[model samples]
Target: MREVKGFNMTQTINVVDAMCGAGKTSWAIQHINENIGQNRKLAFGDSGEPMKYIYVTPFLNEVERIRQATDIDFFEPEVKGTKIKSFKALITLGKSVATTHELFKKLDLDILDAIEEKGYTLIMDEVASVLEQYDISKSDIKLLIDNGTIEIGENDKVIWLDDDYKGKFSDMKILAESDNLILQNGIAMFWTMNTRAFEAFDEVYVLTYMFDGQTQCKYYEANDIKFKKYSVEKSGDHYELIDYDPTIEPRKETYEKLNIYVDDESNKKKSPLNSNYDSREKLTNQQRSSQLSSTWFRKTATPRDLKQLNNNLRNYFRQVQPTENEYIFWTTISDFAPTLKNPKCKWNKSNDRTSDNFVALNARATNSYGNCTSMAYVYNRFINPMERNFFREYGIEVDQDKLAVSDLIQFLFRGCIRNDEPMNCYIPAERMRSLLKDWSEFKI
Candidate 1:
């Protein structure tokens, strides 16, 4: 945190760290309008030209939202030629533009050349995928190093020593040349967004919820970039910036409204546990961890266990709590969506996805499912152990539990509950249920 929330121009990296329904996007639009009016005369690197902005969001639909709400003329990456070419032309013209995060990641030295003098501000609608593991086998990496094709530098930085290397690793060579590829433990490869992109901008505003629990936050700290924190609050008909508070939880009414289908003796009777398995067998916390996880859904689960899960899903939507005409949503890993999907009821599935009502477990930063009345988040979320080890190699200890809770929170907000509407949620995994409960009570 750099400064208290206000209309300040000094901070280069600003995080509007607000909750899901706190109207963060509205505040950003207002801030843009104010900057357009004032032209940020006292802002850093200002040369009396009008302030230029590049609003980047996670989805193309959000790009349209910014274009529709803002008063300024917004240029998108055109389809005439390469999108990068159109974006480069926009940078040369010093115009405020809107695009997706994918294009923002592709910003190279070429774009930096055009943008260095433009003094453009960046408004990111959500945290972009700042760090991701690059899938390559350890032996393949060994071949690259053993053959004098590449060299591992300090801190496992993969350096392309072979200038004439235009073979199978050409794509890796390009990324390595641009300083985006990172090696972990001399085996795993990772792709991180270049921090130089932020240096090219006059200032940056990242509008998102739970920024601390995200990987991008850790990425910034590792690079020694300092950022200020603010929160969006509605005063009357308008929104304003307030000091960030991490403890902001949903209202008590909201807690009462959301029903995380509890598993009890009575509920188990509705979807009976098959007698094939011994009822007296007690599961340890370790054994129970597999329940509703990818391991259980894909491999270890017995037919009776899956039947009970499917039956439980049907019991909630059809037997226990029924709704009319409204959309329903549920999430699991993409691979297990079909395995757990309820094909009996139409409303149990949301439209235009997987030809059924299946949402992804990692879904976030969108308002496309506001009308969905019910959602079943079936997977027991966990961070990849290899990815966690990658961060640890850089002296950054990842919070696996917080990240899991954060993922569930982001996915839950995608439903009608975000607008303070009552909704039904079912989590078959006991760990996920406890995590959700802890979050609702501000326990974690």
Candidate 2:
């Protein structure tokens, strides 16, 4: 975890790269540890708020470097301050939110299906290699693969769940998704598969081993980031990269790890569970002329018919239903009319003032009457302020109150309006601004 000078430029995202046996894992562990330690208090080591840091790498074995370095349990740390999470855990969190919110449904389905389809063979191969290396029996390997529950697939590979891969067709889909597999290959094949998997990752670290028994490390942001070698010795507290000997064996496993794999091997395009595909269906045809006639058209109004209907509605309002009260309300609320009184001279409680209906009617008559004016007032005075806050929160550059309420409602609920659900924090701008100002210490 040697801190590189001037490396703390916090971009919203970054990539770190080094070759295998380089100090990428070491750097990650140290960065996380320092961040946690800086934020911690004495004794129980409370960091106040959980710092979100996600370390994504290919293979669960890569997880070991950081896990061992940080002295934390696999996926569960007893000594807690900062949360150290794998990319899979982060994806799961996002997936859970997506399910509840429907925000990431398509992405989740695509990724999940891909992993479920291919994750099995990879797991089986890895487990077989681990078992053979550790002198475990085939039955013992099977038991461990079935029961102990180790995640063995590469990153970005769809994760396999026990239920999704059961029965005959499952193994077929798995074979389709993965290459043909043979069990005799050892760690080398698994390593190659892992390398391919790791390449899919958003970031990677590359390292080089030298003839003098020293290793060099360089950071690559991603696969796109140029890979470079280093001759420097220091990495962090664990193993010295310059002194590292890959032949010395970093670690070895004895008992086979329990892992999960898909069960079936056939590809079956299953349809919706409750739908009856063989059921008879019928369509009825009626006369086109009759359908276009007055009675038929009235019964089944098309867009043209709907437009006529709306025009008829507006005409009805013009003739009969347009209420004068809306005009009065709009004018009064908008303060758009000339009848507004000077507060000092026209105090209602004064003797010179008159309680006059004539004055009120005259005031109402001073402006036009209709629902449109009242609706405009409702939108401009009431809705627009709330909408401005909405626009600010959403990072939208344009005013969106021109959008229909149903559209806005969908946006709010779908998280397009804000990353957090709009229902939880929607506020009128004036009120929110006042509260924010009054708080004095609030920022953003």
Per-residue lDDT of model 1, residues 34-117, tens digit only:
767456344355466888799999788889989999888888989788898899998888788899988888887668757766
What candidate 1 gets wrong by more than 4 Å, as runs, is 1-12, 40-45, 162-168, 246-249, 265-280, 294-299, 302-304, 323-326, 344-354
The digit string of per-residue lDDT tens for model 2 on 1-444 reads 112222322311122222223344455455455555233222366435323332333234344444566632324221244232222343444321101101111122234343332221110000111000123345643443466322234322222345445554364234324422112221111110111222222222332222111111111121122333322234356533333333332111100110101112265532221111112233134322222222333344355543433343233224333423222121112121122222111223232323311122112101111111111011111223322332233243331222222121212222211122111111112222222232222121
Candidate 1 overall lDDT versus native: 0.74
Q: What are the runs in model 2 whose C-alpha is more than 4 Å off?
A: 1-25, 34-65, 68-90, 94-172, 178-196, 206-226, 235-444
TM-score of 2: 0.21
- In model 1, the Cα lDDT at residue 344 comes to 35
